[model samples]
Target: MMLPSDFELHRPATVGEAVALRAELGEAAALYAGGTELLLAMKLGVLDYEHLIDLKRIAGLRGVTCAGGELRIGAAVTHRELETHPDVVRELPGLAALERAVANVRVRAAGTLAGNLAFAEPHADPPALLVALGARVVLVGGEGSRELALEDFLVGAYETELGEDELIEAIVVPVGAPGAVYRKFQVLERPAVGVAAVGNLVGGVFDGAPTVVVGAVDERPVRVGAEMLDGAALDDEGAFAALAEAAAEAVEPVDDLSGSEDYKRHLTGVLAKRAVQALGDV
Candidate 1:
């Protein structure tokens, strides 16, 4: 690809400074961290920012912590860190496993989970599992800070609820879903369909309806209604088939190089079933 146009780089020492720069520059500025996505977009001429406010220098924006029944992942934490972090591996191995498979080793080494969600890429893997795990994002801006569900933060493909003056601070995921599993189909650099299933299954039945989320096949991660899997049994093929069908019917995919609409829909079902079965295996 061609080199991106010249842009001023600002290294903010603190979150306040970063937010201030964002507010002052507005749309002319973009937050930078793990340029795996941002730099590529800039180089490809899809985005042209006059200024890039780097958040990496902000000490508050790094590391992972656990408190109040949630895992708080910092905005600056790279995918490689997450994939290898002891806390992540122990608390949410499914997520760690998913992170290990994102893109390739290079992308994972530099891509931030916050950036991945902030970019709002439809073909990503984190959002689906995060959503199924009931993840929320903390956003800081000139007005202060606010938290919202990951599902709500993402508006559509290449779209989000983020404001020009706002930057993500962290992604908060609830703890205790040990049975969660993520499955995807990828023949290209990105997945064609991604699915995540989370629940406590024991004795061939789930304690409650499992939370299922489908991504890549749609503009954003689509959550399959819990009601659809109510009273479903993992041991029964018919029940699994019904749950899979429900997931497939929930996504509205478009034709692309990844596959046709029907093909994506089929993959969604297949992946959804596999995800649930993976949960059973856990």
Candidate 2:
């Protein structure tokens, strides 16, 4: 498959301008950012659009800021940018590590986090961690702006709740957690399973049930509450293994090229355990 050569590219300099283009063009146009996923889909003939609204030139949409216990990541912020951003490194190093391991260096340098969520690819890593961290997306359109939880925004594999006339403005992530960890198992281009665990530790002991999300094995990230780990010591292998088993059972993994259902389920457990252990080490 090859990209259609006839599609017109429209450059928008502002969020308002981008919204107007989206409203005017409707289904005929598609938002263009990093082009990491969109352009590939076009080339593969999976999507067709008569217009491509280029948003690279849009001002006020390419920086990251930390305030009021959260991090605001602009729509145009790329994976590489997030991986090394000072605020991200200092405040959310787990996320920075996750961003660093996204696909490869080329994709990291060119792919935006907003684009990743908008594409909603299940095998991707960010969604699981971001969802665990309680992230939200800010969307703008002709009707103005609205915010949606990352979990709610992503409907399923290759799908989202984004309106046809709306564009993602930024991703907001809460900044405080005792610590969080993300771990994944990959054999091909994408992971077979990804797990993220966020927990609060009080004086070196688990204070509450941790949030463990299993991704890449299902249509969307599956959030599993690790109640068994509540008040368990970090080195409690029995508790961590129980959490892993629960996470594996929580996801409805499909049989695909990534692996058989059983294979992915096993990977889910393995990664879930690793994620918890990693969080404890932090």
lDDT, candidates in the order shown: 0.90, 0.90
- State TM-scores per candidate: 0.97, 0.97
Name the 10 consecutive residues with the lowest summed lDDT in model 1. 225-234
C-alpha displacement of 149 in model 2, angstroms? 0.8
lDDT of 1 by residue, 1-282 (tens): 999999999999999999999999988999999999999999999999999999987999999998788899999999999999998998999999999999999999988999999999999999999999999999999889999999999999899999888999999999876588999999999999999989876676777788889988888989886554556676777878887788889999999999999998888888888888777788
**What tens-digit string does per-residue lDDT give for candidate 2 at 35-66?**
99999888988888999999878877889999
Stretches of candidate 2 exceeding 4 Å from the true structure: none
- What overall lDDT, based on C-alpha atoms, would model 1 receive against the true structure? 0.90
Inter-residue clash pairs, candidate 1: none
Position 276, candidate 2: lDDT: 80
